[model samples]
Target: MDTSFVKTPQIQQLLDKAAGLQESGGNPRLKAIVRDLTEALMALIVRHDISESEFWLAMKFLGEGAGEIGLIVPGSGLEHFLDLYMDAKDAEAGRSGGTPRTIEGPLYVADAPLVEGNADLSSDPDPDAQVLHMTGTVTGPEGEPVGDAIVHVWHANSKGWYSHFDPTGEQTPFNNRRRIKLAPDGRYAFHSRMPSGYSVPPGGATDQLMQALGRHGSRPAHVHFFIEAPGYRTLTTQINFGDDPFAADDFAFGTREGLLPVPSRQGDSAYIAFDFQLQRAATAAEQGFSARSRAEAG
Candidate 1:
């Protein structure tokens, strides 16, 4: 038993053994990251005087929280931080002429119906929901047209429930979800209902965590997009309604300066015109990747 509060050789030896326990083979980056993470955790535990019981309890909480990691990440600002970091890198490289990226919140599903140039996102409309018509043009970084780009769009309903996550159980399989291909002129349009802002489920872990942290889990009305073309970098972003109360204060920190689309009401319907510019993929790997692949990989 070691009874010294000074420099501990046993601690260093334990860390070394732990780092070497995993067979890294030739992956020095992975090994280094693992070692760094483990050392930081150990240092944190020791510095904070965290007991074994407290550590185990925290582990159990994390295990339970793993199911909702998607929500937890954006709620904890990790997703937005990554987006910001990527934006910084892009800025540093002077590669910044395109639609800004946002969080692809955990609700994305890859199996929406594909349409040609225009789509009716909601086949059957909610009686009280405001009809929405959205049109956009997909362009390259140099403002040239990007024809045949696939754009997947999805949004919540009037009651703030996504079609896949509908609580009422009356929604169609892919209701309010559609994928549209850009026309030869790079134009696309869709018809859907204006979605309402939503809050996290009342008794769920996310809601509980927000309450514990004295935060609310409300999100503003927004439409999600996953755009992919042959030679451009895959774009994952969303368009938030300008009039939403939480537009400026999104709980997920997903809102950006240029992403808000103010609607124009026309005869019991709303219309929004937005455009997306995609950056040319500088690398082959990025050119070959799609939003679906990135979402699944993430």
Candidate 2:
């Protein structure tokens, strides 16, 4: 039962063979990763004395909740770990002075409606929703306006549900989403209904796991953004409302110091004035968005 047993020659041989080290023709990088991961798991098992029943039950939970695996990844902090890892790599590389990147949740759908500069996100008015007007400028780290910048924004509805994932099925295509082509001055603005904070589905996989871990599956009222421009590194980040109750403890790990903006009451509407700064790219690859499989609107 000692953890040292997992490091024995027998376990090492088992891990090597299980990761296809004895075989040929597979990717070398993948084989190495698999071996390392298996070795870590073996150590964890010995350290925790994980029962077979407990392991199988966990696997069963994963198998049964395949659809919510995306939600579970962020809630479990794996996706956030990727973000943090990249942030550390950037810091070590002396890449500094840009908006901090964070986890891009699974709900992003590509190709929302494009607008010249400013466009109302909600096509129809909801009597119960509060109007939110947001305006910002995209500039380089030196405060110079970035040309040809595009600000892609999306958020949940007043009911704390996204357009595609809403159970009510009342939202239209690209609801509360817009891609704004910035002006020559790098200014972009839009107005939409304020989105409410949302929690995972009741009795769902993410909710169940969070509850078992004595945590809540809630995200604060926030706006998701993808800002990209030629010659500047693409910025992936979101701004949470400073006043939201869950802003300090976002379940998705999307909250960062420079990304929280407190809104001001402007008569009957709320207004948020926040600017974005992008770092100049050192290579062509940094000018484009990170390659991740995402949902696309036809």
Candidate 3:
């Protein structure tokens, strides 16, 4: 028998010490978890002949897995987890009578320009796509207008690239992005050209991981929002353009029936109006401006 492979009472004592440290907490449930982890690690050391190469390989793979977390989070459905949790909380509190919440997406820029009623937001100089007029009211759960609500909006161009992230930089001067504060009646509107659906970055780390997992990386054509007010809970959601082929199949699983914007063709513009209802802030501490303050500070 190899002396290096010998099992010793000191090894058992060290594991017991680890177990004791984990169990010393006041929570009984956490103590049980400590016991379970200690037992599992001890068993693995005894049963599996884990070579140094295999150990290093496991560490390497874990690092790669950690790096892949953001890719998996958006594509593998964890973004919806927040929505589901909030929905359940709203339902429990009898506050479910608002526009459903959706993911804010990773691309939303916090400090976009604030414009009045109908500002042209299209960055494309040619303007080949149809101009769109989107209007909406921000109302409370009791149907009262939320006059102070701010509506932040962003979307891609016809070629499926956001101004900041696209390599072209042709539209880099903050085109197709703006924020509007609701009027005294809690209404706001803006104009922008319709956007096209685009796949996630192709032939990159995100794509390589998706390809290895036999998955396609694509998101439907949609506009992103971060709506907020003094007392109401902040709402982060997206309005999907109805015409995209992947509208129903968003890889982020963010589509909701009530969140889809109805499209109508006017003489020269596509018209969309959506009303958003928000739940009132239940606590005084929750009524502060943390989200907006953070953005402003940044």
lDDT of 1 by residue, 106-221 (tens): 87766688888568999666989889999979999888999979998989988998876677888877778888977889999988887898998787777878898999999999
Ranking by TM-score: 2, 1, 3
lDDT, candidate 3, at 161:
84
Indicate which candidate wins on TM-score: 2
> Mind giving the per-residue lDDT tens digits that candidate 2 earns over 2-105?
98998899988998899999998799999999999988988898889999999899899999888888789989899889988988988999888888887778
Model 3 regions lying over 4 Å from their true place: 1-71, 123-126, 266-268, 284-298
Instruction: Provide the overall lDDT of each model, using Cα atoms, as 2-decimal numbers.
Output: 0.83, 0.88, 0.74
Q: Return the TM-score for each candidate structure.
A: 0.90, 0.96, 0.75
User: In model 2, which regions exceed 4 Å deviation?
Assistant: none
Higher-lDDT candidate of 1 and 3: 1
lDDT: which candidate is best? 2
**What value of lDDT does candidate 2 attain over all alpha carbons?**
0.88
RMSD to the native, candidate 3? 6.2
